[model samples]
Target: MYVRTSEVRGDPARLDEGLRLIREEIYPAVTAMDGCAGMSVLFDRNICRVVATTSWRSEDAMWASTETVRALRESAERALGGTGGSEVHQWEVAVAHHDHPVPDGAHARLTWMSCKPALIDRAVDLFRMVALPQIQEFDGFCGTTLMVDRGAGRIVGTAAVESRGAIESSRDAAAMIRERFSTELDATVDGVEEMEVAFAHLHVPEMV
Candidate 1:
């Protein structure tokens, strides 16, 4: 599976308006496109940051939607009163596992890591064997997805939980495991964040 994420930092006051536009306009449009598997949004009110992610069944489908996506993204930013320029990234869904569909009140903890390009495979293997199991053991754990930019040696891991409390409860343990895994994988932790899963509607593609 392939994923595209567009990140924008904007005013907190306009967040609701942005979300509304996304649901009413962007979501339906993207999902209707060929090979579109799913779409999601992540928001951090405190930081006034929002990220919109779309999953595609194939690379070609993802690339084909670029023009439409560009226009929709511009509309979203305008509605949101977004300030800074957006950052867009493409990734391969290296690992995906779900115990259940993401719930209404789900929250996610995200970690961004950087490592040597040649060690990307090693990082994925370590995550599947060690990190994933540990994460599943946490209370209220719903699912986990690891996205990778192999050429850039970038890995973004998202772990979903039932609520904010669940995210907090698992922090200490999660951090310990993250630290150990980073060491073994020779990865440097760039940033770790927790945010509300503002919207999540992803269909697991057969290919994934």
Candidate 2:
């Protein structure tokens, strides 16, 4: 599977209206497009940042809709009070797993990492074989996804959970595991993001 992400930092004041436009206009239009598998939105109200991700069944499907998606992305960004445009990225999906239904008020934590391109496969193996099983036991955990930009040696791992409180309580433990995991993969932690799962309708098949 392949994914495209559109990220924009905009006016917090216009957030409500922006969300309305996304729910009513942008979402329906995009989902109805050919080969579009699923979509999700991530919002960090504190930073007034929003990211929308669309999954495609194939690379061709993702690239084929790029122009149209770009136009819609700009519209959505403007609705959120953006001026220039949104940042976009394409990624290959390595893992997307969730068996439980996403409950109300789901949250997600994203960890961005980078390793030598040569070690990408080893990093992936360590994540799936070690980190994942341990994460599944976290309180209120829902699912996780690992996306890669192989050429750039970029990895973005997302952990979906039930609520804010769960996040607060687990930060310490999560950080410890994250540190060790990165060390094992010989990767550097680029950054971390915490946000609400604005909406998740991804039909991303489970990939271990």
Candidate 2 lDDT trough over 10 residues, lowest sum: 95-104
- Global Cα RMSD, each model: 1.4, 1.1
Please list the residue runs of candidate 2 whose C-alpha ends up more than 4 Å from where it truly belongs after superposition.
none
The deviation in Å at residue 52 for candidate 2 is 0.8
lDDT value, residue 203 of candidate 2: 81
- lDDT of each candidate versus the true structure: 0.89, 0.87
- Which candidate leads the pack in lDDT? 1
Q: Quote each prediction's TM-score.
A: 0.96, 0.96
lDDT of 1 by residue, 13-129 (tens): 999899899999899999999999989998998877888899999999999999999899989999888874899999999888888777887899999999999999998888898
